[model samples]
Target: MKQTGVAILGAGRWGKHLVRNFLAHPDACLVAVVDPYPETLAAIKDKYNLAPEVRLATDWESIRDLPTIEAVVIATPAVTHYTIIKDALNQGKHVLAEKPLTLDVAECLELCHLAQENQRQLMVDHTYLFHPAVKRAQEVVHSGCLGDLRYGYAARTNLGPVRQDVDSLWDLAIHDIAIFNHCLGQLPVQVQANGRVWLQFQKEFQVSQLPVEKEFQVSQLPVESSEDNQGCSQSLTPQQPANLPYGNAKGEQPANLQPANLQPSTPQPSTPQGLADLVQLTLSYPTGFQAFIHLCWLNPDKQRRLGIVGTQGTLIFDEMVAQAPLTIQHGYFEQNGSTLSLLVNIVKFLISNHLNHFIQYAIAFLTVSACPNLHQYLLVWVGAQLVQILSCLSQSLHQGGVPVTVPQLPK
Candidate 1:
């Protein structure tokens, strides 16, 4: 097996998972690890039991001089992703970084263009996509078992893994968002979101007197009124907000709107519901296919589940517990008509074949040879989810819960 010398950046929570996975892969050789903090680097090194020759750097600069590093896996903050990945691509190294590409769209486009120009592969480490169930779901959808995909949806939620750098969408929903596209065979036409901002006004408000409604102002778009007393009303149209400045917009009021007043509305503010981290989206295609995605981080049961409903049949994927294989249902003849029955246990099938397929595709791409019949349509579908995520978030903030149109990918 040809070993690819790989370096891992960021030894935080997710970094450890990448390190362990890469170490297990026969085709990958873990060469260097980088992190700014001494403690984090030390913990990973001690845990992985690395040799003295395995370079550990407190800064990215130290490893730049190493000519042997063939690829870099960036597990750093969302803010630094573009710079690091751009530098790596510029140096002609392959990249397998985390999602959201960049916190904003411009950087993402720049990275995408750079990868194409350099002929270097830029695979986001959306590990859920590699799951057997997800692979099976994609297969059924593309293989015509599901017929024409009518709609698609997914849920990825958890109580406490929140980060201030990116919202629930970038942090958790990106996984399902990516997978939704993979299974549906289209990009989202529109995206909108509804979320709460705990610290919108920051220290300006007497936090004690503030009603939860005012505290949890929808992050979509601001409500505008001729008068403040008329009650701030905004439309939640479904259009994804692109290139959001990372949490830096705090304390600033929504455009054309004033800072929220702490006084409760008439009839008293409703009992403060827990934080709402839900993002719902829809997509439309010229071919008449539609996709809807609902992602909530508030679910007590942190399961990653998706359902693809179509004309002929449906494909359901459950990623709640590890090792639970994807179960498939296809149309079958009972006595006189059609009935649904299990076709395959997806988990076992994928665990046995997905990586091998990836390896074959990679080799084919490098050798300029005809590759095995695998589904690249999944990539086309994922692109749609990314667009819808931004569109829905934009609409949910301004419009009163309406679906927005997603921009079409350049043909």
Candidate 2:
């Protein structure tokens, strides 16, 4: 079996996962790893027990010219995707990049053009698309079981792992955005976003421990309207106020918020510039379908779930605690009818669906309990999906860049 030689461009948290998957894949050879941080490189090398033949470099240039490396997986920062992808494509290598493709549509288009010009496969790692739960949800949607998709709600939130490079939208919401596009079979025609900067620094940094500064903290800063509010309202046709503040619907600051005072000689802590810790987005699709995404880095509990409401019924893809991840509840209520009839139908729908769901849940739990390696099975399932994506990219490249289909917002 011929193997496609692949190099990884990052060795951070998610990057390391890619490295493991690539190493485990039989059709791919992990030829190199490129990261500027020595600790990361050392850790990956030690963890993988990388042989001397597998090159380890501090920069992409070292492996870009290597003939053995036919492809590159980019798990770097969003801001650097365009440049790295361009360089990799220029080197005649197929590229698989992490999501949000690029911060700008023009950059994404340019990368697509470069891939076409170079006859190399260019794909984004929209990992959720390959998840069993998301795939099942897509199946349910496309099967028309959830008749006439009306709207979707996706929530992806966590307490920490806050990043400085990108806001919550780009960091977390991008996953659901891709998932929404996948499930709906189309991208949004318009997007409206509202966000706030909550924790400017890491949680461990205490206000009392910090040298007092005269500058007001972000929490104490007065709320202001987002610059995009007016345009977003007009373009996206938002039902709610486009400029609403993060934690409050009324846009009022917390009552306990107070300004910080410090000495002139106090050392200032570095905070991310123009990055939001919480973001809410409304995406309107051409098919009259709407999607609401709520992203936060300050939540007490982690959540990864998506709910789709349709004319027929509602489907919830709760990735966190769900046994099957995809749960379908059948039947809908009629708004215009006799009050007694409406009440009877509602009661019947609830009783029938709840009883059916309980039976399914019980069976699912028993099956899972019977399988000792269920967790490992899930891991392999995910890995198989990744391998399938790689196979598609390699085949596409062999077919002279057949133009891999990607989700694109309607223009």
Candidate 3:
């Protein structure tokens, strides 16, 4: 195997993981780790025992000046992707970048074009597409076991934590969008969606009927109660919560509460109830195959599950199960609705229990094998699917639940 010198930009969480993986890969030489944070650079140097020759630079100038650095893996923020990737390609280096190639569509297109102009490979790190269970599901879908593709749905959500700079769609939903595109091999024609911001300084919620009823009741609550006092209760339904003045008077508007005084009492509209803290987005394909994606940052469980339904059968991939089986249901909805069955066990093939199945697959194909071209092609698929998913999602956020068409990259 020919050794390729690789440099990792960003020593943050994901960046460190990439650094560790590349350091362990026999075919890769860890050229450097770049980050602006001094602590991050010191931590990487101490934790990984980086060689003296492996330069740690805080700026792009130093990175470009490194001797014999042939490639760069960018784990920086989306805003910096266009510049960094453009520079890397211009330098005649192959590149792998994290999702959301760029925050702006025009910039993303420019980056792609630059890569082509330079004849450099521009790969996106969409981890899910390489997942063992997802891979199994893709194989089954292509095998005709699922019959004619009908509709596919997925949800990735949790309410426990919110991001500072990005929305639920970008932070989490992007993963499923990539998977959706990968499974369907096409993008949605149009997208219309509604979103709400809650629990953050900035909020963008969907406009819905629930807000009308809530606003009516909040107006009836104590006039002095600041909206902040009502912020915690915003998650409540029309039925007033306990310990609040509105709870005692059911179905009766408080007589003392006046519309004028209601100015302070009237709550600011936030996200909608039952909107899944995340979302369940439906993607329509020209072939009549529909895909639904549900993502949440609020679910109590830490599990990623995917289900694909076709005209003849169904496929389920759950990460929690011991074997993480890629179960298939064939002849579904038949005379007896066919039968429930476990089709295959793809998780065991993973290199270890600690590493994710997808990472293992990438490592296997990229380093421990002779399938360089094959692995490169897979990276391209991951990148293109990611671009489509996010594009549709952006459309959905702008439009009102209108379907959006996903675009394809030129071969």
Compare the candidates by TM-score and give the number of the best one. Answer: 3
Q: For each of the candidates, give the backbone clash count.
A: 31, 3, 37
Q: Global CA lDDT of candidate 2, please? A: 0.55
Candidate 2 backbone collisions, by pair: 212-262, 213-262, 214-262
Residues 49-135 of candidate 2 have per-residue lDDT tens digits of 988899988778767899988878776644456678888888887777665465555566567667657776666655565566665
By lDDT, the best candidate is 3
lDDT of 2 at 156: 80
Model 3: ten consecutive residues of lowest lDDT: 227-236
Off by over 4 Å in 1: 195-276, 331-392, 395-399
lDDT of each: 0.52, 0.55, 0.56
CA-RMSD of model 2: 15.9
Report the C-alpha lDDT of model 3 over 1-411, residue by residue, as the tens digit: 677778877776567677888888776788887776566689889999999999887666677856567777777655456678888888888777766565555566677677667777677666766665666666777788777877776655432333323445655666666666666666666544455433232333332101211222323333221111111111112343322211111124435435464232222233332222355577666677777676655454555666787767777765556464466776645343576544432233232243354444554443442334346434444565455556566556645555566666555
How far in Å is the alpha carbon of 150 misplaced in model 1? 3.8
